[model samples]
Target: MAIAAASTSSFPHLNHTLFPKCPSLSHHYHFRPLRVPFTVRASSAVVLERDSITQPQVTSKVELFACPVCFEPLIRKGPPGFNLPAIYRSGFKCATCNKTYSSKNIYLDLTITAGTKDYTESQPARTELFRSPLVSFLYERGWRQNFNRSGFPGPDEEFNMAQEFFKPSEGGVLVDVSCGSGLFSRKFAKSGTYSKVVALDFSENMLRQCYDFIKNDDTILATNLALVRADVSRLPFASGSIDAVHAGAALHCWPSPSNAIAEINRILRSGGVFVGTTFLRVSSTTPEILRPFIRQRVSQSYSYFTQEEIEDLCSTCGLINYTSKVQQSFIMFTAQKP
Candidate 1:
């Protein structure tokens, strides 16, 4: 029962969780799972080739990101290589305080800790299961399967809904918080709707998988896409600098959901939107037999929220125009900063 430690630095060494000591990377697994319903095809497709259709303009907007600890703008330093051209994507350091950060593959490591504090020791312990490259491999390979466990709209549908919710017009900056394997971020980047689609996650291995999927496949320019390793509780961005945020099925994983929500509210500009999905508490409509199973499945790391709780959290953050859809255990929400 070795739970996963949560996810690392530079050209800094990778923490164990991010790059767990695995036996080999030789194993191959199919990305699609076997049991998806007929109505839904595998949500993820082959990694498409990079196209310069919608790369973001990096030179004009480097001041968007701030140092997590010092709250100063971060400037690109050193050589370039993470997805974007050398001009836009490179190692980062604080402009004023002079603090520096590193990367694991394309993911710019920003958090001192790989993630926010784990809610319970067991929570991280269970996550340890993800440390193995094999586990990561399986998870990414079968993302659609795990995602479909609740039997709702698939990723493609959710992507469309998110586009409608955020309405990412030109020059908008959208951050995909806790983007696992770039499933949703890639779609947003390719759509060319937003000026930039940043894929931020704490797991180096997860980001590595994303880079592996996209590096040679697509022509997405460096300016349009970025990979950052950061904590949701402590995002590395200036206040009110972001236009929208998306976190799919990731809120329950945060140690401090309240803190994370507040941070999301903090970074969003007035009228900016936050759209994401999560698990909710068992509903009255749920069959009696399944309640125990669901309860047993929820570990300490994952906090199940009710519709009321979700709305409460959003309202407390001063977010308006809140809307959500609940079906059994799955919940999707969109809110706007006032």
Candidate 2:
């Protein structure tokens, strides 16, 4: 990675007073004046002055981002000029739509569903089922208990396989799709495997809880962890930009699994890995006693895949080297973009 030298004229005059270094987090951060005021673009470079000897070199990650609506690279909206650091921690408006998203407590808001018919006209029950405060509470609090009783993959093996599957990449950006309550996303951030981990969920309440869960934690810093509210079907990332992607126990909830998987493949780099676990449809071969519970879970699910169905789905999405493991009613799988 090349550090964009501050001498370039493409950067804006950064107001250092307004954008002070975040001291509370204890992470290496700094800012310097941009020589040439410029908007964020594919050719744009983020230049920051070194505030300390220990501060890591600045590199451009904006190229990894895109407008969900248009698939165009997003430009940051600054008062007079924009700084990438400011865009990361505080907030920045989208240059295209002038929509503002903030990182309140380091939780990045990426959803554009507000004021749309789907949000305003949808029944309260439909929306609340996923984004309600109460549902988020249950997911954050009682989900573990529910999992234990539901005969899903236990946390131990689930996380172990996640670590194993994603163990290849040492650093770079990794996205956690539908990261409910930020459980594994925060865990992966704490482990220091990736330079950054994006915790993306559709529910604002879920992301709010996710921010609360890690706001005070020392190991998980804003530099490495970002909570983004986004739909899995239409990911807001640049093509072939993401290093890896992961989702856990949330695939069944997707409205269109095929579209979501296609989007996942679209964002991942050619060699990037995609790993996740989800509910598998129970069959007649399953024990009679477990059928009712499985059916109950599947009833709420948009769709459930058997092992063969999932493998075929991955293949259709252009992911190769597919591998799957069945544990109880859960299916764990890993594949890579070829």
Candidate 3:
């Protein structure tokens, strides 16, 4: 839940405290459920790793853990006791802000549970919680601005990779699949590269976010855009209708990615483009070591794509021009339907 702006000065101290509490670090659970109150609004918010399957919000067993806001570390001791394993619950002294809340005391629930169908279904709930309040609050407070402001860092790199493999404008209809808040979609719309930028996603909240951002920006509005609410697995478009398809940080959440590719191929025109970027697999064989990042997302979960897998999927989808690269912890794969 902490952003990059949060200080990490106390990281060393925090690590010291954590190791002492759990001496058998390897055996200790990598993550425990915590209800993080992200906004000033008093509501339980979920906080988890960005790469694991276990979510913190949906679980019944919530524990207690407090991370210092200033240093973004769990306070080991505070106030009168600099060395005590304690938290300054009341308030904290800040050099710049007179006495401020240096810590946010929250829960770290560790309830026992089984991974059944019911347990797995909890993923959607976690995704919703993140998309609704977490992402919304981040957007409203300008957290997302930092993500895109510095010139859409990831997209340019991705597009550059695609360009190396194919011409910049094999232009026709482009579909920005799983376009969160429409940053990539707007980028394409503003690029003046395609005739239509079909901004699509399963989450209405996310699609709406993209819709609002695009409609307000004259550059994006200038280019034709159509928002479609449809799951990727069962795309509503006719076969071979789309010219290019690109999805940024959003393949893992599809539930059935292979089927989604089938649909993507179904809609993309012959000799069209299909581009994707995903996280490298975080180790599916060992869940215990990395099972607590929480929530299914394009960055985590089924998010990462292996090179062989990418080529295989492209080959299966009838895409001929297969090109891929690993950049900034992402597998950028570009293929063309021929």
Each prediction's total of clashing residue pairs, residues at least 3 apart in sequence or on different chains, is 22, 2, 8
lDDT (10s digit) by residue, model 1, range 113-230? 5333564323253334444566556666775567666744778988998889887434598999988778898988888788778898766677777777776654664447887877
What are the candidates' C-alpha RMSDs? 13.0, 6.5, 21.8
Per-residue lDDT tens digits for candidate 3, residues 1-338, read 33322122423333332333333322333212122221111113212222224323322111111221221212212211111112211122222222222221111111111112366323344235435745743553565445343223455665666544435435566777877666677777677677666676655567556645644455555465655444566554546667888887666556667887877887777777788766545333325555456333334334445556668987886777787665334567787777
TM-score of each: 0.72, 0.75, 0.52
TM-score of 2: 0.75
Write candidate 2's Cα lDDT for 17-87 as tens digits. Answer: 22434454325332232233333332453223233354443434453456677665554433221222344
For all candidates in order, the CA lDDT equals: 0.65, 0.65, 0.49
Off by over 4 Å in 2: 1-63, 77-89, 93-100, 104-106, 114-128, 283-297
The lDDT of model 2 is 0.65
Error of 1 at 239 (Å): 0.5
Better of 1 and 3 by lDDT: 1
Report model 3's TM-score to 2 decimal places.
0.52
lDDT of 1 at 197: 83
